[model samples]
Target: MSASAQGYVAAELARGGYQNVHDLLSQACATHPQRTAFSCGDDHLTYAELGSRADAFARYLRYHAGLQPGDRLALQLPNCLQYPIAVFGALKAGLVIVNTNPQYTAAEARHQFHDSGAKAILVLDRLLPLVRAVQADTELQQIILTSVDDLQQPIYESQEDGTLRFMQALRLGEQRSPVQREAGLDRLALLQYTGGTTGVSKGAMLTHRNLLANVLQTIELFDQPGLLEPEKDVRIAPLPLYHIMAFATNCLSSVGMGLHTVFIRDGRNLDETIGAMQRHPFSLLSGINTLFVGLMNHPEFRRIDFSHLKWATSGGAPLNSEVGRRWQALTGAPIREGFGLTEASPVVATGTQLSPYREGYIGQALIETELRTVDDEGNDVPPETPGELWLRGPQVMQGYWQRPDETAKVLTPDGWLKTGDIALLDADGFVKIVDRKKDMILVSGFNVFPNEIEDVLMQHPSVRECVAVGVPDARKGEAVKVFVSLKDDTVDERALLEHCRQYLTGYKMPSFLELRDELPKTAVGKLLRRQLRDEASAAAS
Candidate 1:
């Protein structure tokens, strides 16, 4: 039997109409052309202003850059004014936008750029070194590098066609590749990376239709029809745009509803994001579990006025029940936790403003999405039983890009994308994640795969046998814990962890280490991850 709550009935969500996300933007532009569309610091972009900028960007890409349709452009940026302009412009130009996290090092950047086969890249000045490091190995034919002050030039002078040859040597000084562009909703629009069972990241092929479908559904779920007066709601967008939830709730939903979004340039600048909320008193706040949890801890969070907040949505990791309780107690607005992946246009299920916020459950599926749990053999599991959650909907991605064999393994023949997430649906129809097929850790909104870490760990001669597991952490949500069986008695656990920091990201390194004689294993010699996890919990308690 699954460990799900009982008597939860779900209502269908509407993902209807509009071929792709482009129409949503176009519709909002037509409906609220003059309303403010986005804000960064003192700068405000009206719907007409944003749409026109996107239009100029589209024309600029086509005529100046000469990027053809379906040509992928690696977008390496953090949340700012350029992000939306570049994203929507790429969509308008009919090019696939492959989003990369700005924090990624050159190695990570190179891998993604190589895998995506991007012809061009748009990088922020601060991150130019990373792009410069990987440029030689990548397939990129051209680069469109911009600075922080790129959009500050009156929006008239700065947003124009300015050409500069980036490199002097290697015969690339005087020449720039012309642009090729695409137009339509059916075309591939975005390729967002999600971790695979194998621990390597795979690009999920999200069509314009897929993104637009999820965006429409999200609007239906969160839009306060009567409460949110047209163009009156201000939404706080602090999360990274590369994540689907942030993209949908912040960028896409804001466009469709014509809500003005305050772009949070840096998480390090949480004060700015929080102050914007207090000064403007945002009507809607959407982010991951970590963002909200961190905000709640901020001394400013206690001083803010909750009366203006109409909706709060959290996804990425499960909302810690304690965090949810504290939020409700503090702000009065319930946290509407949702479920999504890079594969399902990022939103499979969501709790609406109308639904009572539950402690752990990620509310009902959006309209048109059919979620079911099945055993290993693909047989349907009875209701309330934890099983592998599979999603079938218009929002589901086509497949993994250029990974047919791997895609076939996860994407079922009848269109069910095996989420690999262990989930349970109650009799009333609410879904809650319980486990994952891979030894993957959800550190805030990012996926930290153990295999990636284990490979790094094996490189150290001191690491005899190490198995990593997700240990519960209240702040970041989950901390990585590795149980080690040493080959040499002289190896110190602390030294091994420090060694891991060299190759693995901070979130992926083992925060807790346990020296063991020999790890518990199955008869087939597979390390029993469950046993290690149980040990971690027992020791913590």
Candidate 2:
């Protein structure tokens, strides 16, 4: 099956249609001109309208902003109509996109902008102050700003520090001649920054072929079971698009399939998220465990109609078995968990509708993708044995931007990219991610995985959210520390410890546990275990 899927992907690409990301957009627009491409709140854009606006932005960047092909353009906006316009326009203008998180701090923003050497930035007005704080530190020559309602309503232009409003830029670009640049498959298309969980964030350089191939690979998998129908499926995109997973899935794959995507700017806002669901009656949905747990806890979640829902996906982090079971029970649709890192264009393995759901398994690798589990010595591990996961495929990135030394650490010269994840491969070829390689806890010379501890804790009804990390212990070398937020205040720490004692071994049990109002997480709802570990180490010191 893997070999045939690889052949099919190669044949599909060899047939020659959409050579670049912009070409993908063009094809979608031509095929579904009247269909809705994207929506946020009450504002939406048809395929044709999206294409026209993207073209205008492309022309504006080339003619007005004076950006050349291969130049970097940073997009720092939430999920809104302007995001697609900026993304497609930047691609159309032959510019590489640097997707910046709107919630980034000044230091984080400065690092990404300076590192990417972005020539221009399209930012949301609310975040202009943060941009202003970091713009002088970057090489940015142009600043294009937009408000949430800029596309839906007219607003007077604010010429603050020679910045151009998003709508104004579009209007001005429409008057200029169209831009026609040849962006080949090998040309770099994106600088997707990884979460600096290990250290400073590094940008993973993705090319046109890398993204386009992943899109084709994903479409092939979805098409096998008729899970997605072009111009028919309504996908709810509540995750931040700046993240690689969402970018590849929602921005690239969904567009290629001509699926209507409803963007929820803030998934944390339960009211707004539930409202969007009420409005769209979506057929497809994607989210993380935190989001699923939050929605299930909300009263409105039960009221929203899930009749049209055909498929659901979970990624960005491991899906707790309890959470998955609850989600399936509530929606009548099982959540198929997938796994990937930014270096692999954010998708390597995902479960298809044809595959039976398995707890903790991320199913098989995508078409044209290869997977390996290896020991620390780089030798292949036995099947079903936990080791570092290695992948090789079209979706693997070219390398880290301007960081060959850093790139060499993860990517082998033989073309396999070390995923830095501890995983196991079963006889059926299913991949089960155990935990991050760096996050493993060593207690008295025994290796303890935090995902195992957290998964067990999540089965307790009183545990709302939790993360387990290894903290310093003079006696044990390192001890398990579990941090949790509760759903029921009646359940005390003793009860939680007793619950853990029932499921965990003596060495695996938490030596220290702390209750928090909430845990730290990335913008995409991934737990910040590294941060918690750092804090715990500091406290121990």
Candidate 3:
């Protein structure tokens, strides 16, 4: 508590041992040697096994692929066990891992691959088509396709579509590449892409220290109740691993704390997740609002046991009040909603999982994180007033890759990373996000950036001018709402909708449509979305 004690601790921290995620994992693997570190359906991996596989993959990447240090490898997959395997493997091989969401389109995928200068790609078979379309144009040289049952022996065929219809589908991956280097803790572990909710997606250059700091920060956040103790804590891994929340909370947290990370294979099966929850008596379950809502909606939700649930953190999107209340009522537990972006190592603030419910608020800063609410000019805003949330802490990312101009705009000279969402902090320091600076929609937990939507809408010949806005939705928090004005008055709503569907994901497509004689624009002729939102709200009222 005293200044002398603080200085002493800081001096000790500077002594440096394991400087990265790989170093952190190495210690964990050694400490918990035979403990189960990761599990999916019937497949379980012990800490020693996980570390061994990663090292083997690392050797494979170097000896066979000839990928030297500082190179990037693009990985696009869902929440399968291989997600961690590949991520750890890449880190072991001294390569930067570029994470991609399987749901991304060819255009979205290309932006990340080209921007990051990735040389190799690891993909799931079902997503192969999406990557194949863009590989010819990108810098990637090798493609390694993984099956859903790669971890478990005698892999079953779940489906030809790559869903792993049965656990027996996995065959030995014929070794194609060899990995040759040891990953130093100081090197980059992940080149995570920004959601681009505001504009073009930029890769946040996160080093081993950046990610490792956040992992320790998270451990402190939950250390209050000792909820993270291994052998006692079991975590649900249903959230997409590509997202930082799952990568950090579900996978990295498990390794850092020596807990079991259970993968929710085939999220379509509600019984599987629920069954795992009961069988394992999971102590902690971290996820987004949509997942909790979906879980409660399932017919078997009532039957699953929540007797052992100790930590339930909600992030990646706002946790709806209705879902929160219902979950508390059913399970007698609070869904602690937190807030973070792809930057900041994806954790700026979080609510207390063991405390009472604080509806509509993303809780206090984790230990050692200092936050500020500032206006466009960077001056501090009064408490309870909305403004962009800026943070200067151990968890904030280093910078954007290769885009000095872009990074300069977001990172303040004093080290604060400007989060584009408008937020308000109560006198108690709890943050509540009121609005977003970017024209982005939060459909469930997915980001639907308006610029991307407008780009798709503009393809229609009849679309003269258009604007994409987020409309409130009861179930999804917000849905893509589009406003359009036709050039020749020859297009119908159906045709325009069809054009958008062909290019974007189902969640990104507009849920509400409006036709206008001419869109509301500023005096200079730039379309004004706030004005359109005002009109839409007025009509709704």
Estimated TM-score for each candidate = 0.89, 0.82, 0.90
Ranking by lDDT: 2, 1, 3
Q: Which 10 residues in a row give candidate 3 its minimum summed lDDT?
A: 165-174
Please give the lDDT score for candidate 2: 0.84
Better of 1 and 2 by lDDT: 2
Candidates 2 and 3 compared by TM-score, better number: 3
Number of clashes found in candidate 1: 19
lDDT of 2 by residue, 1-541 (tens): 1623556656777775656788878888778899999999998999999999999999999999999989999999888888888898998888999998786667668999999999899998888888888889899889888898897795548768779888889899999998885568899999998633344568999988888888888887866546667767899988888878888898888888899999998876778888988988699998876677778888889888999998688887667688789888989988988887788887898997788777878898887888889999999989999999999998899999998988999889999998888899987779998766777675543446787788789999989999998876644557889999998798988899998887665667899999999999999999898899999989986
Runs of candidate 2 exceeding 4 Å displacement: 1-4, 195-198, 440-541
| Candidate 2 residue 402 C-alpha distance from true site, Å | 0.8
Model 1 TM: 0.89
For model 3, what is the alpha-carbon lDDT of residue 6? 23
Model 3: per-residue lDDT, tens digit, 198-220? 55788998877678777777766
Cα lDDT, all candidates: 0.76, 0.84, 0.75
Sliding window of 10 residues with minimal summed lDDT for model 1:
165-174
